[model samples]
Target: MTEKALTIITQREDLPQLFGKRIENQAAIEEIISKIEFESRSITFDIETKDGQATCRSLAAKIASAKSALDKAGKAKKDEYTVTTKLIDADRNLAKSRLQALQDEIRQPLTELEQREAQRKAQHEANLAALGFVNIQAHDHVGSDLVKERIVFLENTVIDDSWEEYKSQALEVKDNALRILRPELERVKKREDEQAELARLRAEQAQREQQEREERIAREATAKAKADAERQAQQIAQESERKEREAKEREARLIAEKESAELRAKQQAEDAAKREREAIEAERLEAERLEAKRQANKKHRDAIFIAAKDDLVAGGVDEEVAKQVIKLIHENKISNVTIKF
Candidate 1:
């Protein structure tokens, strides 16, 4: 029997190259189990002789004989003795056949187990790839469905090795990887939803503000229109009042002009009547003064005529001549009164 490291010794050189890696590391294989710890299945090696020729007790003697033969060969090499060995020559062919069968029996289970392990590792890597997909950038959000499945798969596969110190660390690493990636991804998704909602609220607020501003503008316009209407009304009232005042002034002016004209005409008529009365009074006074002077002259003439007649009667001239002289004396009455002709 030959000896080597557990991993290298168990490998089947005759198997297909593609299938070799599957069984290479499994402890189920006889060669691989032989180099493992004391609990390994192939902890002891047994030698078998031809059937019916030797029992279990004789098998031990055969192993002893083989060991002795190998020791002789080593000593002979040192002594420079050349000895032809026949023990290996007689039984090597049969031993080779038996060893080949035993290794095949062990390798069958190892190949199945390794195939299962490879599948598990492939599934784990696929899960990792899905979780760490480049499409899911740092700021992006993705679903956790695939990642959760991967975690479940890893948990199931880790059952047998989780107790081992080295495997426990590897399991912890897997756990940590999942722990770090999952929540942050979920949080990013939540934040994205919140941002969308915030945008909606802002849009609504802007619309509301615009509506309020429009309403305010409309109210202001209405108020301005009302104020303008009020001012216009006041202006109209003032204009109407001014026109009425003008009409009243025109009426008053006409009345005053007519009254003034009537007063002037009445005063002129009164002045003309006064002037006529003064002229009449003056003429009457002049007529009375002339009549009194005429009366005094008539009385003086009557006295003088009486005196002239008396003188003519006393003188007694011839009858005819005396009569003519008396007539002359009456005509010349002033002469008898010492009148100067």
Candidate 2:
């Protein structure tokens, strides 16, 4: 009987281009396996040859031979898978190393150039700030006629890598600005000083005028007080002279009234004495006249009695009876009777 071989062909299209050669090597191994003589599913050999049936022992021998061929094919496929995976890992590692080296080479010069540019920009800004000319549009005073040309020149200038040119131009503009500002500052100070001096002089003049006005008021008050005192003294002197003249006139009138009263008392005393003397003389004359009348009446009465007595005696014729009738007649015992002889 001719011997037949069992083989398996491995096909893989998913592998990378770098591992495509490994697929050929795997194909050669598959050819070797196909040439091997074994009892398998693809290769057929009869265990019972022209006999009625086969016993269990012959079937066991055929199964053992088929198992050995299957084990060899599985081992070959496992070995191929392991070696191909290792080759792909080595290729990936080589590619990563090459890419890292290329990146380092390209970036080194670019980094150095960037660092230098940053440094130059910082130096330019610092120099402009020191000159006080940064953001020039914000300071309109820099464009004044005093330093306009110099300021405009500095503003238009560009800053290169050389620091010396920028510094020299900025210092020149600063000097020009100071030169213009110094004289104006001095002029303002001089005007303020002159105004202050004028104010002080005016204050002194006002004070002097006020002092003179006060002195004049005081002198006028003193003169008015003296005049009032002199007028009061003259009034007092005139009042005293009037009182003295009134006292002297009253004393003279009292002396004249006293002498007149004494003369009136003497005249009244003389009139009283004359009236007493006249009354005494009239009383003495009345006493003498009454005495003479009493004497004459007595004589007349005696004669009448004697005659009547004689007539009675002659009629009767008795002397004694005649005496008695005469006596009765003298005594006036008989009334309204005449004696007849």
Give the candidate number with the greatest TM-score.
1
Which candidate leads the pack in lDDT?
1
The runs of at least 3 residues in candidate 2 whose Cα sits more than 4 Å from the true structure, single-residue gaps closed, are: 1-262, 303-341
- Local distance difference test, candidate 2: 0.58
Backbone clashes in model 1: 0
Cα RMSD (Å) per model? Answer: 47.0, 46.0
**What's the C-alpha lDDT at position 133 in model 1?**
41
Model 2: which ten-residue window has the lowest total lDDT? 9-18
TM-score of 2: 0.22
In TM-score terms, candidate 1 sits at 0.24
What are the lDDT figures for the candidates, one per model? 0.59, 0.58
- Candidate 2 lDDT at 50 equals 43
Candidate 2 displacement at residue 63 in angstroms: 99
Give lDDT tens digits, candidate 1, residues 57-147. Answer: 5444544544454344445454432233455555786798899999989899998999998877776666555433433334344455544
